[model samples]
Target: MNTPPSPLEAERTDGSSVRIGALVPLTRPGWAEAGRHLLAGLELAVREVNDTGGIVGRPLELVVRDSAADPTRAAAAVDELARLGVAAVAGEYHSVVARAAAARADALGLPFLCSSAVLDALTEQPTDWVARLAPPQSRGWQLYADFLLGAGHGRIAVAADSSVYWATGTRILRDHLAPRGGTVIELDMRALTPAAVCDELVEQGATALLLLVGYPDPAVSVVKAVRRDQRLAEVLLGAPAGQPEFAEWAALLGDDGAAVPFLRYLPERLSPLGTRVEKALRERLAEAPSFVAFEGYDTIAVLADVLRSHGTDRARTAASWASVAVDGTRGQIRFSRTPGISVWQWAWPSIQVVDRDPAEPDRFRVLHAG
Candidate 1:
């Protein structure tokens, strides 16, 4: 088998590029589509930054590394990026991978701005080295639980794979739903087939089935199985992890993918700056961009701002997280210490419960907002 290409680097013969390490999942088993959108956003922002005037007249550059959704690989990338002397590091889609990167970055005194991972405990202990743009998992998932309750879904079934991310999501949902007179039925996807999940849902008399599993594989299969089951026609399908947000989900499942409500981070209305970025991102991505893409763009935007104001020193960049106030594609972005969360976090990003319209599979319909 051919070996994977080396980490991409900017070609600046004079070596004047101010590099930021980008940790993205560009290969399979890692959500490659999300990575593409994220990299597009990062590239767009970098181009825009260079177009006007790059950081103090030096061109901003991205050193790309594929995390491949592996925690060990991500940590190693952090070590390598640090050794390469990047000013800062950004981008990661998987929470577990981000957590490892965060720990390594903190230990190495490198600043890392996390783009999309939402695990509550990003690092075992709070440190100044890491900051995140994605709202914490508890905040987003709790809002999802509230949406389910408002939609009259008290009896919920979750088909989940065993992983810290999925398990954390399950705990958040259970904790949020239990006191609100809701019942959560857990289905272990590791042992149960899609058909078996359908059987379990019926037996448990669940009104909604939440997918706490990975995309395409069992998720697509589970959606197909549920959609085809005549007895489960009225049951609501959900993916709190935002599985249906990407174009691949639609391409594979078509109309069956529609109406499966999932969480998304976007405002009901975009600001003027946001509107412009959205159009540019759409053109760059050749499709309507997911929130993850905006997160990527915003990550660069924030970093550019910090680098310009604080210079390229890693310590200054890490210290500058408390003062970030960039206008992101979603809203005004700012980072702060939130309760129970270790990383400097964007206090909140706009949260919404949305689904693809059955009539127009490509169109999304917002069901609730938080």
Candidate 2:
């Protein structure tokens, strides 16, 4: 196996382009829609950076790799990028895959700024080599729980698939809800059909059903089945993992997809910088960009700032996480050691529980914020 370049060897040669390895899930089995939006944001930021004089006058290049939602593939890509001498790595929407990439990058002494993964335990132990922009699972899910309580939803059912991400989310919801007089009932997607899910919700008398499964398959089917069921007409549908943020959800489920609340990491109002980037991203994606796209854009924005301030030394970039204060599209981006979180975290980005309006279906309504 080939080894990664050491700190001294990873330094940029004068006049050579500076490379930032981009780990994105651009292919199938991945959330390709989210990946496209993420790539669009990252590409937009890179273009803006180069147009403004690049990083220290050497053009900043994004070396893209498709993570494809596979952890092993993501880890392999990290190794390949390290051998290719990227100064730092950025972008990944899947929490499990991001954890794998972060571990590999840490082992290789490569700095990685995770764009959108929210799993609280990003690494087994804290390290300066890794940092994240998205709010962690615990914080976001607890807020979702609070939203449920505030809305008079005391009994909640989670129809979740078998995955670390979903399992962690279920645990968070359960832990957070139990003490607050809220009850969480778990419905395993593996054993229950969509109709069965509806039956369970009715039997359990669940006031709200949260989709903790993947999109377009069980999640879409569950929503459809529940919507068609007369007994479930009044039950609230929620997707705290943000599956409804993309256009594909609407295009697939139409009205059925509306009013299903999900967590999104965008401010209620965009900053001036966020406003400009949202317009550009809309032009690039040809649709309203999701919060994932904003995350992708912000990832590059922070990385560019670091590379310019600390040079292309991986060690220096890793150390500079504590000092990052770039104006991201969402908010002022900064990193610090957050309690119970293993990686350097943004502490938060603005969080909202938003859903497409049933009245319009194209516009979003902010239901709750934290």
Candidate 3:
């Protein structure tokens, strides 16, 4: 794990208040809204914790910094959070940012609970200071592939962005299907226009497309291009989990987005508790609550429980993140280290396929359960 002693300059914890640093993309170019929603979730949990008299006898505090949705920027933010003397760090919407923050948090001997970052490698290795609330990409890809094959969409076309997370997912999906003799056409999203890629897929008799882009901007852009190509109307469109994180992807695409299905964290049927959480978040935010928001809320809730059990000692608190089991917004949350995936990861997390209404993209219906 290579966790070091807490730095001398790091904020000293004397139980006056338990501060947890939050890293989100508050000012990123395309991910500003994602940052806002993720932060809302963290704040929601913080308010709940403080309202209940906090941990032990100290009130809970969140020291927030913009991760900027970039790996380098997020790494620096993790250092800043450690220097601020937070007991632990949580909240990250982008996998790239989470990747850097996780490593840096480990080096600083600070506990970090990631809210949402599905890249396979973030938790692939053992890190004493890190535990993720999201599932590994390997699991997500398997779920996605199973859904596509079961739906009779075997000839797939993949459009992958240049980002590390997107590229890694595309590679993982490709490898997963190789043993089944599945045919996949791969295209570089950064190098080609969406229309051109659609045309190539059409020519190749591709029955489906998996958009492996990091942001909604590019994913929606490709959906628009594909929709305009009237000849490819029957092509089954699919996306990684990023598509459902932001409402704009569906709202902006309208009918086009509704036709495409994407991985989403919501269960197939909302339980009574889930309905209440949805109502609370809808009242809080103008748009519908995303899984990212719920993840942020759950991450802190789990950490607060761990803090109650382990006290404010950062090392002990960090080590206790793996055993967290709390029901916040979602059902019971837990973690395990898998042989192929990262250490202390939420394994086999279920995700559903979502298709939004053309007239009301804010509202969606789950078409498939994962």
Candidate 4:
């Protein structure tokens, strides 16, 4: 349960707080830590903005709502934020929730910038008021395919849960693999036990099994099943984000989780701002921040610029967001017109393949940069 937000006086006579709204899964399985990291990033951005004279000399505020990681609830959250008359809205880690929020933002003609959540279909047809900061899933899948095929692994078996994020990401990989001489034996993981999926992949001459299940339960099932099977030594395992994004994933698999490759956008080097952000996160949250946290901070920073330039004018902000390019934590932050990659998607994105060895469970090594 959440306490009601206390009304604050706007600096102007209008009595608005110059607020930005957030939709995040504050109370959902597999998302609590992620939500905390995102909220931390957002709060940091809000503080920084306010300290630096704020937007038009008014302190910025955030009105956050729990998304519960559901599409319908996410949409409702957007509607509620719209009713609050927020100048802009952002923050979401799940693609399903992002898709709903994006659509609702479009309907309301509110400026919305998604923090994280990458599915190509989210931006396949661009909306006037919505854009995403993360690269689309197709871009991530392309990096994964290039890495696998380049490493002499072509006979790959892909398995993903029925969730929209995993399904779209797996299909993108399947599409890319065929043209590159890599064969994909697809496994639709709908209630099928990990043992069943692994048996089929091993039988089909699969050299590697790619698990795109966003949540860890299904991923754990597949990995645990594979480790228990006698043939595990013969096949490699890969996952989106290179194992799970959390340390708990390492705690769960322990030794068996070693050497599994996954794509992650961690910069080969952290910028000065990145260093400060990480230090702040550790000081406040007592944990090292993930790439997701950087994303959240950058999104709010960009939106703060929009609100500063456009002054809460939705039409003006939406029109100017694409042209408002600034260097962010990873690299240059800009939208492009590249085909297949959405008009709003970032172009020239690169990701590193990372793995955690059983001997060094907490450390991740960069295997390849794609």
Give per-residue CA lDDT, model 1, range 274-323, as digits (tens).
89999999999899999999999999999999988887878888899999
lDDT of 3 by residue, 279-321 (tens): 7777777778888778888888899998887777798876775
lDDT per residue as tens, model 4, 82-179:
89889888889888888888888888888888887777777446666877777777777788788888889999887876776776776777788888
Clashes of each: 0, 0, 3, 1
- The better candidate by lDDT, 1 or 3, is 1
Error of 2 at 14 (Å): 1.9
lDDT of 2 by residue, 92-207 (tens): 99999999999999899999999999999999888999999999999999999999999999999999999999999999999998998999999999999999998999999999
Q: Please, what is the whole-model Cα lDDT of each candidate in the order they appear? A: 0.92, 0.93, 0.77, 0.77
Question: Which ranking of candidates, highest lDDT first?
Answer: 2, 1, 4, 3
TM-score of each: 0.95, 0.96, 0.90, 0.91
Clashing pairs in 4: 242-262
The reply for model 4, stretches above 4 Å from the true place, is 1-16, 241-243, 341-343
Worst 10 residues of 2 by lDDT: 6-15
Best by TM-score: 2
Error of 1 at 196 (Å): 0.8
Better of 1 and 2 by TM-score: 2
